[model samples]
Target chain A: MELELESEGGELVVPVELLYGITEELTVTVVLPFRDPFENGRLGSVGLRAKWRFATRFSPGRADAVAAVGGITVPRSSADGPQAGPVIIAGLAAGRESRRWYYFAGVRTAIHLADEGNDPGEQLLLNVAWGVRPWLTEYLAPDLVLLVEASSRTEGRTRVNGQTVDASGGEVLSVAPAFLLSYRNVMLKGGVQIPVWEHLNDAGRSEDVRILAALELHW
Target chain B: MNRTLFVLLAGFAFGVTPAAAQDAQRDSTEQVAPAAHPDIVMRVDGLACPFCAHGLERKLDALEATETVEIRLNEGLVLLYLRDEHSVSDQALTKAVTDAGFVVRAIERHPPTEGTD
Candidate 1:
């Protein structure tokens, strides 16, 4: 079980995820998110995702792996939010984990399909992260890890009734510093993303700093 | 005649006591056998966090022969103590670790030596 909360641009989003491991290398997840844009808060799109770790290498206390993730988000009614059609998502990620250090890089793309006359912006996201463990500890002991992540997001323009929405999309780059604390099977993590650069279209709202936190449990 | 019978009964009682005591001692020793050194030790990779390592613990514990498990995260080592008279194969152990999303770097077996008890 995973419960995540994020505050961005005066909007609050809460996403709950349930994940199941089918095999050591395969996992499935269901995401249900609730978003509040300062008025008429409601449930957002529902998403289903599958992750497959296809390749791995190991040496001593270190390991590296590559994985692919694919998912689909089913849109809710127009009253839910701006999303009016289903979205397809695909991504590839590779990472390495060692006793004292970790690193990961990934890219994801979301294609929003048109529904009726409303077309939402398609998005591309790129991310990189590095982490370190402050102190080495044995299992069942409290452990803490610090990480820094950088991400860039770009979105294509949206069109409604065959007319392009001038302020619909643009690009932003952000960096986040986060921490993860774990004990046995439970983990808590949080981060704040600070936008460093932005290029929005005319009348587009500039990106703001976002705060995120999550709790995860495994049994 | 009574005196002779009493002496014979006393001799029999004395003989049975030591044998029963020996049996009890053997039983106690057998009970402590499982507490000896772990039968198998595995060096697992990617055990960087306690939360992620918990899945590996659960997977290894599910093996049929496993009785108990101990993990040393800093060293990426997992110790398995098996049930008496039970053994798990290397293939099974490797699969268990792999399924838990980790790699088995190396495995060492220290099966009990015969007559060491």
Candidate 2:
């Protein structure tokens, strides 16, 4: 679930996701995010994500992995906006994990597949996160991990009927801090994103804060 | 709202210490090779939570030889049960765990003990 307050309005999202590991090298996930912007509630979008691990290096105390992620997001409701259809996303992620700390970096981009005379904003995403776990134990204890991340998004211009409507789409950055807690097959994570910088065209809303909470059940 | 988030961050900063880490490494040598219906135990690092450990389970379960996979979070151990007529090498175990984003400190193979299904 996510709650975001922006200069224009507020939005809430409840997303259900199904993830499966097809093999040691491949994984797939499907997500359906329910969205509510103010009084109207509707299906936001459907998305599919696939990740392929290309390289992994392991040692006694540390491990590093590199993977490529590809996905597609399709808007489900007209409330989405013009230039809304299927957007293909691709990215590469690299991470290092140890007993105490984990860090990851990734970059992603959304390429719009829209009809003629409709221009939707393409999105670019870059993110880096670092997390640390305290209290390594020999018995059953709830594991807790604290994380901090920097996320940046760059949006292109929006055009309607082949005409530019909002040119103020550029870049926005946020600093998010989060925590994870888990016992066995269940995990919970919560965080808040605070805007740190912006260089945008007039088309995008300035966000106040983004609150997030997620739960995962693994078999 | 920002203050609330900052307070949450500070709360975490003061909550725990790194001294609680589970860093026990077992000796892999002197262990017998796995028999039919093998039971494999491995010590792992970076298994801080169930979500992270789930990756290891998924990878191990994908093998045709694996019948079941179990993770003991606190002990940082993964146990795999193999079907009869199939076996997994230590190198394969290491690669699978590493690909799942964790490190294997040691791996041991054993015959299925009595009462262990």
Best candidate according to DockQ: 1
Model 1 alpha-carbon drift over 4 Å, by segment: A36-41, B1-36, B112-117
What's the CA error at residue B24 for candidate 2, in Å?
A: 24
On residues A1-219, what C-alpha lDDT tens digit does candidate 2 reach at each position?
Answer: 122222224666667688887876698988876666335757667889999989977654466889999999877647566445688999999998766787999999998876656667889999999999876642234678889999999988877677776664688899999987764445667888888998877634565788777665555
lDDT of candidate 1 over B52-72, digit per residue (tens): 887888798789888778888
Taking the tens digit of each residue's C-alpha lDDT, what string does model 1 give over A1-219? 776778755767778899998987899999998777335568788899999989988776677989999999998876464655889999999999787998999999999889888897889999999999988887756788899999999999999978999977899999999998876666777899999998988564878899987767676
Per-prediction DockQ? 0.24, 0.19
- TM-score: model 1 vs. ground truth: 0.83
Alpha carbon lDDT of residue A120, candidate 2? Answer: 77
Residue pairs that clash (backbone atoms under 3 angstroms), model 2: A136-B20, A136-B21, A136-B22, A168-A201, A168-A202, A169-A201
The models' CA-based lDDT, in order, is 0.80, 0.70
iRMS (Å) per candidate: 19.3, 7.4
